[model samples]
Target: MSIKVFLKRVLIITMIILIIISALYIFQDKQRFTKKTGTINFSTKTEEKNILVNKNGEWENFFVKGVNLGASKPGYFPNEYGVTKEDYLRWFNLIAEMNANTIRVYTILKPEFYEALYEFNKDRENPLYIIHGMWVNDNSIEETMNAYDDRIIKNMKRDITSLIDVVHGNAYIPQNSTHASGKYKYDISQYVLGFILGIEWEGYFVYGTDLFNEEITSYDGEYLKLEEGTPFEAFLAQVGDYAVEYESEKYEEQRIIAFANWPPTDPLIQPYEPEDYNDIAQIDVDKIKGTEKFETGMFASYHIYPNYPNFLNMEPEYTEFIDDEGKNNSYRAYLKKINNHHEIPVIVTEFGVPSSRGIAHFDSTRGFDQGNLSENEQAEIIPELYEDIVKENMAGAIVFSWQDEWFKTSWNTNDLIDTERTAYWLDEQTNEQFYGLLSFDTGEEHVKSYPDGNFSEWENSKAIINDDEAKLYMDSDESYIYFKLNIKDLDLENDSVYIPIDVTPNSGAYKSSLFGLEFDRGVDFIIEIKGKENSRVYIHDYYDYLRYRAKSLPSIQKFTEERTKDMDNFNYIYQYLMENVDIYIKETKQKLIKDEQIFESGKLIYGNGNPNSDEYNSLADFFIVGDEIEIRIPWQLLNFYDPSKQKVAGDYCVEGLNPKPIRISKIYSGINVKRGEELVYSSNLQSYSWKEWNTPSYHERLKPAYYSVQKMFEDE
Candidate 1:
C-alpha cells in the first residue's frame, strides 16, 4: 500500500500499451507496401457473349500486352543460359516494369521457373500471370499424312494432363533429357489465366489424312467427313477439349484455352475455289463438334506475319478493301475474314518481323519474308499491328519473343554450317534468331569511323594486314559503317570480291563451314561485290556467297573433263548467282534490300534513295577511284537501329589483323564471271583481320529498338 509501489505499477502498464501500439503500426506499414492480385475470370453470358472478366466482376476488356519468353542468349532452351534464381527475379521484374502483365511459355520449364513464380507472387498484389502452353512433339510423325497419329495424340494428351498437374502442384516431374526433374514446387494455378495447346501445324502434309476413323459424321446436322474437314482441325478440338476438362476437373475454375494455328492452317491466302477450301484447316470455331467443351472460355489464336506466304498478294475470293498506305492491302482483309469466321474473341499468339540482313523470301507488293525488318523498323511497325489488334476488337496479342536466340536457324541460313561461330553470336543474316525484342549484351562501343570512299576519313581508324596483299582499314560512325581497302594490282573487273564482317565477337565457330573468306560462325554480314556495272556495291549476306549459290551452282568436285559442265551451263549459273543469289542470300536482307530493281544505281531505285536523307536507305554507295575503293554504307543498312548514339571521333588501334577474319580464303577461286571468251584469273586470294577491341556490339545498336518496344507496350 506504499505510494512508490503504485507509481511503479502505472509506469509498467503504460510501457506495455506503447509496445502494442508500435507493433500494430508496423503491421499496417507492411500491409501498405504489399501488392494486390487482380486475377482474371471468365463469364459465359451466351454462346457469343463469353468474355474475360477481372476478379472485381467488371467486364474485363484487358488487351493482353504480353511477351513470349525464350532463353535467346546462350541457347533457346530455358536452362541454357545458366539462369539462376536472381536472373528469373530480375527478368520477371523487368517484364512487369515493361507494362506487360502476362508472360507466355511454349513448354513446361524446369522447377526453378515454378519456384521463381512463387517467389515473385508470394505476397505481391499485382502479380504476373501465366498463359501456360502444352507442347506437342511434331518430330515423331512417321509420315506427313499422319498428322493425327494415335501415338502422337496420346503423347499430347499426356503432356496436357501433366502440364495441368504441374500448374496445380499435383505432379512430381522426373527430370527428363529436355526438362530438369523436380517436384511441382508451387501452386501457380490461381494465376494461370489460359492455356495454349499445340503449335503451328503444317496442314499441307496432312491435307487428306484419314488417321481417325471415329470421326464425327456431322456437327449440328451438317455433313462432315475426314477429307472434307481438316484432320488438324479435328486434332485441335480434341486437344482443346482435354485441356479445358483437365483444368476444370482439377482447379474447378474457368480458364481460357486456345489452339495454336498459323497461316498454313488458316490458308494464308483466301480459299477462292472449293479445291482451296478442302485442303486448309477449317478455323470456324462455331462449326467444331467440341465447341461445347470450350464453352467455359475459347479464344481464336493464330501466328500471322505480313510477308510470309505473301497473303497480301492473294486476291480475296469474296471481297477486299484498301488500307492506310493504299496498296490493295489485303492483310487486314484476311484478318477480318478470320475474325468473322470465329464467333469467339481472337488473339494473335505470334506476330512479328525480324531484324536481319539475310533474306529467305521476297514479295514485291507486300514486303519480304520473316517480315524482314530492322530493330528500329520493328518498333515502328509493331505498334501499328497492335493498334490494328485493338481496332479489330480482339482480346489480346503476344509478341513472338523476348530475346535473340543464337541457336536458331532460318530457312535461308540453315543449310550452311559454320565451325567458328559460337552459340552466343547473333547472326544478322538469319531472321528467325532476331525476332526477340531484347538481345545479348556485347560489351563497349567501338570508335566512330565514316566511309566516304576516302582513305583520309579512315586515317584515325584501325588498319589490318591481309594474306592476300590487301591493306584493310575499318571504322564506323553513327550514320554509316565505313571500310577502306588498298590492294596492289587489284583486278576490279574479273576477280570476285568479298568483305565478310563479324559484328558479334566471341561467338566463334561451332560448325565448320567457310563463307567467302569470313568465319561463317560469327559473321553477321558479308559483302560480296564484283566488277560488273551495278555489281560494284557490296552484296549483303548472312553466310558466304557459296551458300547463296548452292541452289544454282553445280556440285563441288575436282577438275575432271567428264564432271566439267559446258560453258553455257556454267554461264547460266554464274549469271543467276550474281544477279539473284549472292545479293539476296539471307532472310535478313528483306530489311535492307528490295526484291525489284535492288541493283539499280547509286540511288537505290526501289527503297529509300539517299543515305544522308532521313528516309530509309538500304543500298551502300561507293566511288572506285582507281586501285583504292572508298565505300560508304548507311548504318541502317548494317541493322544499327539508332543514329543518335553514334560518336564523331575515336582513337586508332594498330593491332595486326585478327586470325581467320574471313570465312573462305577468297570468293571461290575469285573468278565470279567469265564472258566474251576472256577467261579471267585470280592469282592471289586473301583473308584479313583487325582488332575487335573497340567494336560496338549488335546489342548496343539494337538497344533503342528493344527499349522502344518495351516503352511502346507500356504506354499502350
Candidate 2:
C-alpha cells in the first residue's frame, strides 16, 4: 500500500481504540457514583428495644465515628460566604472514607450545605447523616444563667423554628443568608440523624438564676422547675421541651436530641465546684419532666478532653483507675460515672486533642495544657478514645473538629494585643487552632513550627532550593515565619547565614550593601547569623545610609581577591571586617537562651520575655540539630500585619519606620555565606530577586487524610 494509505489506516485504528477506552471510562465513572449500601425508610424517627433508630431504618449501636463540621475557618466564614459545593463534596466524601457515618454541625449553615448534601445523597442507598445543632444566644445567658430570660428564650425558640423550617424544605430565609437564593430546594430531614441543642453552657452562671426553682409548664402538659435538676439542667430541659414541639410539629419524624455540655456541666468533677454541688451531675438530664414521657428520647452530650479540669486531681476515688500508659485514666472513670447515672444513651459529642506547641498549663502528671497533642499523637489518641467510649457504652464519639480553625482563641491568647495576634496568624500556643483532622491556614502557614534543627518535620513544606549540597525551606503559621537551612559540612567558626529582607512589596527601589551588594533600594531588614553562637537581626536603616560606600572611607581594594573566594578565610575576612565596619549595627537586644528540652522533645515553647523590653524578639529562637539550623522569627517583631485581619491591601498593615519597631508591609528575603566581614558567598550574587506568592506563611507537618477522604466520596 502507499505511504498515505498506511498512515490513514493507522489513524482509523487509533480512533477505534479511543472510542472503546472512552466507553470504558464512562462505565467506571457511573459505577463509582452508584451506591452499594442497603436503603431503608428514615422518614420518621423510631425506637425499638431502647436503641435509637435512624430515619433510614438503621439502628445506631454504640459505634458512632463522626467529626464536627464548622463553617468558619481562620480567616474565612462559611456562613457569610457560604460553603462552596466543591468544599462540601470534598469534605463529605472524606468523612465517609474515614469510616465515619455522621457529622455534627454547631449551628444552621448556609443553603449551599443543604443543597450539596442533598445532591451528594441523591439516589444513594446510604447517605451521610447529620446531627444538626441549634445555636443558642450564649451572650444573653452568659451573664445571667437564667434560662427563663425572656429575650434569650424567645430568640432561641425562633431560631429553632426557623432551622426546622429550612430543614423541612420550607421557605425559611435568613436575613443575612449567602448564596441562598436558588431554584433547587431540599427537605434534608431524612438525612438529619439528630439535633444538638446548644453549646457547652456555663453552669456557674446558673448559680443564682431562676433556672433552679422557677416552675414552668411545658406545652405537653408537663410541669418543670429548677427543683427537677440544677439550674443549668433545668434550662436545658425547658429548651429541649420547646425543641420537641418545634421539630415534631414541622415533621412527623422524631430525632435524637442532646444539650451540649463541657466539664463545667460535668457530673464527674468540676475544678470550680461550689459549696452546694460537688460535681456537675447535680444538674441531671433525667430529672426533666418530659424526658422519659416522650416517645423519642433525649441523651446527654459532653465535649470531653482528657487533660482538662485536672481530671487526675479529682478525689482519689475518681482517679484510682489507670490506663496502659500508666497515667491516671480519670477520663474513663468520669465517663463511666456519668453513663451509670443516665439511663438513656449518652454521647461524647466532642473529644480530641490539638497539635499545638504552646502549653497553657502543665499538670505534673498529665504534661501540658488540655488538648495539646502532636499530629501523630492526635491521630493515635482518636482510636484509643473511641475504644474507651465504646467500652463505656456511650452512643458515639465525634472528634472535636475536622480541620484547624484559626478564628478560635484560647483563654491565654485572648489577652494578646499585638497586631500579629489580631486573628490573622495561627497561635501555636493557642491549642484551639490545631485540633482539626485537616489543617487549615491560620494567618501563618500552620499553628506552631519548631526550629529544633531537625528537617524531618519539614518534608511537606515548600522549599526554596533543594540541591544535594544544601537545602533552603520556608514555612509559617499565624504567628511566625520560619526558615531552615541544611548544609553538609557547614563551617561554624567563620561561615554565616545572611538574610536580606525587602519589607515593602515591589516598590522597585534598590539599595546596595557591602554584604549584600544587592540591586534593590527596598531592602528594609537584614538578619545575619554565625553558627548557633551569635546573630544580629536589625532594620536595614540601622546602617547610616548616607555613609554607604563613601569615597572618604579608606579603600580596601587589596582584599578584593579574598572576598571573591567561596571558602571562608577567617583571618583575612576578620581584617576586612576591622577596616570597613563603620556602619552603625544595632544588634538585637534580645537574648538567645538555648532550650535543650524543647528541641529534644520537638515542642514549641514561647519564652517569657520582659513585657516592657524595648527589643522585640524578631529572630525569636533557633537551634542546630545535626547539619541543619532552624530559625523562627515572630511576625510582630518583623512588623507584619496579621493576615487573618486583613480584608484588603493597606488594612492594618506595617508601615516601615526609620529605626526601632520597624514596620514591614511586605518583604523579600535571601541567605548569604560570609567569613567575618568578607562575603564568602552570597545568594544575591546568584540571583538578587524576591517574589511573592499566594499561600499561608506557616507550615504544618500534617497533611489532610487524602485517602480516607477520597474513599468517602466513593459509592461504596
Candidate 3:
C-alpha cells in the first residue's frame, strides 16, 4: 500500500474514535440531567414504631414537620375553596421555604392545588410531601344519628373512591357547590405520604351509633377487619379497608392509612373529665387489623390541643407528670400516654395555640390557653409543643393550620355574631380564626391603619369631628373601625374621654348616667378612656349580649329581668357564667341551685398595633400618643352582626331573644371630654358611612410564628 493511502486510513480511524467518545459523553450528561430533574419516586410506610420513607432508593425515618393547609381565605368558607392556583403555588413556596417537608390537607381541594403542587415539585430536588384527607359528611351523621346509616356509608364510600382517583390524577369530578370539582390531571400519588380518613367524630354521634347498632360489632373486609370492636369501629374498619383495596387494586399502589380522631373521642377513660368529653364511645384502632395485602401498614392520627376538655387540668397523672425538661408539662404527659397506648405510629394531626384577643379556654399549668396570646407568645409555644411531641417518640407533629381563617367561629362568640358574614371580616377576638402561622391583614398591601401611635395613615382620612377643641378622624377596614382623636390639650391622667356609638336604631340609650353625658342619637355602645390602663368598652343594658343570653334562658329568669324597649344606662360588658351552688333555706332544706356569675369582658389593652414594630401586639385595642389617641374596635364588639352587609343587632325582646338583623347605612358617633365631675367638651353626632363590600381586601403575611417553626424544623 502507498504511504498516503495508509495515512488517510489512520486519520479516518482516529475521527471515528473521537466521535464515539463524544457520543458517550453526551449520553451520560443527558442521563445525569434527567436524574437531577426527574420525578422523585418516594414511598412512605409505617415500620414497627416509626414512619419510614424510601426516597433515593434508601429508607430513612421521616419526621413530618408538617402544617395543616386549610382551603379558606379571608372572604370564603372551606367548602367554597376560594384559593386560586397562584395562591397555592405561593403558599407551597412559602411552606417549603419555612423548611416544612409535608403539608396535611383535610378534604379534597380544588384541582388547582394538585396542579400547583405538581408544577412546584416537577424540578425540585427535595419536594413537599402531602397527606391527603377525606372529610366525612358531618351533617349526614348528625341527621341520621348513625355512622353505619345507608346514606352515610354510601356517601363515605363514594368520597373514598373519588379521593383515591384524585391522588392518582385520573378522575374528572363534576361541579359541586360544596366540594371541589374539576379535571384532575396532576398525578401526585407518588408524593403523597398517606391518607387521613375522616373528620373529628362528634362524641354523641359515635355513642348513638354504638348504642343503636350493638349487633354490628365486627366488620370483616379484604384488606382490613375489626374484631371485638364497637359498631363505629366496624364502620371505620370498613372505610379503611375500602381505601386500601381501591388504591391497591385500581392503581397498584399502597401507602400509609390512618383514621382521624381527637382527645374528646379517644378510647381512654378520663374519670375527671366532663360528661360531654368523657369517652362516650370507644373507637379502638387497635381492633382494626390489617391483612398481609396491606403492605404499607396503618397508623393512628389525632387532633390534640393542649387546653381543652378540662381533664388535662384536673387529671392527676397529667397534672403531676414531668417532661424531659423536668417541668410539670401536662401536654407532654398526655402525649406520652397516647404514644404508650398506640402500638402503631402515632401522629398529632393538629396542635398549636392561637394568637387571639378573646380567650375561650385556660390552661393553668402550662399557660397554653386557647386564645389571648401575643404573636411572639404563640411563636414560642408552637416549638415547645413540637418538642413535646418529638420527645414523646411519636411519628410527627402537624401544626393546626398554615394560615388564619376568617370564617371560623368559636363556641363562646359564635352566637353573638352572624355566621353567614364571618368570611367577610377578620375577627381577632375569635380564637378559631387566629390559629395560623400566616395572617391575612385587612388591606391589599398592609393594614389600612395600625394603632401604633403613628398618625401618618390618618392624613387622607376625613375628620368626623373638626371642632375647636378636638379633631376626630375615622377610617375602617375589614378588621377594625379606626378612630384618631387629636385633642388640643390632651391629658391621659386627668381628662376622661367618652365616645358613644349608635350602631342600631332599635335598642340604645340617649343618656348614659354612668358617664354623666347624653348623645344626640341612641348609643348602643360606649368607649370610656380614663387613662392608658383604664380604658374599656361598655354596652347599653338593653343591648348587652350577656344580658340577653341570661334573659333567654328560662332557668335563669329570676337572675335576669325582662328586656324592655326603654333605653337603659350603659354598663360594662360582662361574660355570662353558670355554676352549681349549694343553697340552704332556714338550715332545714338543701338544694343545688345553678347560680350565674359575671366577668368583665370588655376591657381594652393599649399597645403598638403596627406589624413592623418590635412591640407589636395583635390584641392592642388603642394607642395614645403625645396629643393624639388612636382606637381600633372590632365590628362584633359593637353588636354589628354582619358588617359586610351593614347589618346590626335589632331589638332582641321583640324578636324573641335571637336578635333580628337590622340594616343600617351609617353609624352615628359623638365624643365628649370630662374633667373631674364637670363635662368640659362635647361634639355633635357624626355619621360615618362606608360602601358595603361582599369581597374583602386582604394581604398574606407570615407571622413571627412561621420563622420560629421554620427554625425548629430546620434544626431537626
- Per-residue lDDT, model 3, residue 11, is 100
254-296 per-residue lDDT for model 1 (tens digits): 5777777766666333433222322354444444543443445
Residues 1-716 of candidate 2 have per-residue lDDT tens digits of: 99999999999999999999999986875453243443222332324213355444555542456789888554454445435778888888777767677788887777778888988887777677888887766567765566667766777777777666667666456463322333225778777777787776664555545345555422232322234445456566677777775555445445667777776656544432222222334455666554343556667777877665533343454467776667666677777877887776677889766766544433233443344444545555655566667678787778778877766665543433232333345555456777787775333433345554335778776667656556667765555667777766667776776666555442222444345445333554555666554564554322212112233333334324444231122110110000111121123322222211111112123322111233312123676665677777654334343433321122111222122232333345666666666765555311222233333353323233323333332322
Cα displacement (angstroms), candidate 3, residue 8, comes to 64
Q: Residue 27 lDDT in model 2?
A: 83
Q: Number of the top candidate by TM-score?
A: 3
Q: How far is candidate 1 from the true structure (C-alpha RMSD, Å)?
A: 12.8
lDDT of 2: 0.54
Question: What is the full ranking by lDDT, best candidate first?
Answer: 3, 2, 1
Scanning candidate 3 in windows of ten residues, the lowest lDDT window is 577-586
Q: Which rank order by TM-score, best down to worst?
A: 3, 1, 2
The best candidate in terms of lDDT: 3
Model 2 stretches astray by more than 4 angstroms: 1-51, 54-62, 78-82, 143-145, 176-184, 211-227, 268-282, 289-293, 311-314, 324-327, 362-372, 417-423, 441-479, 484-716
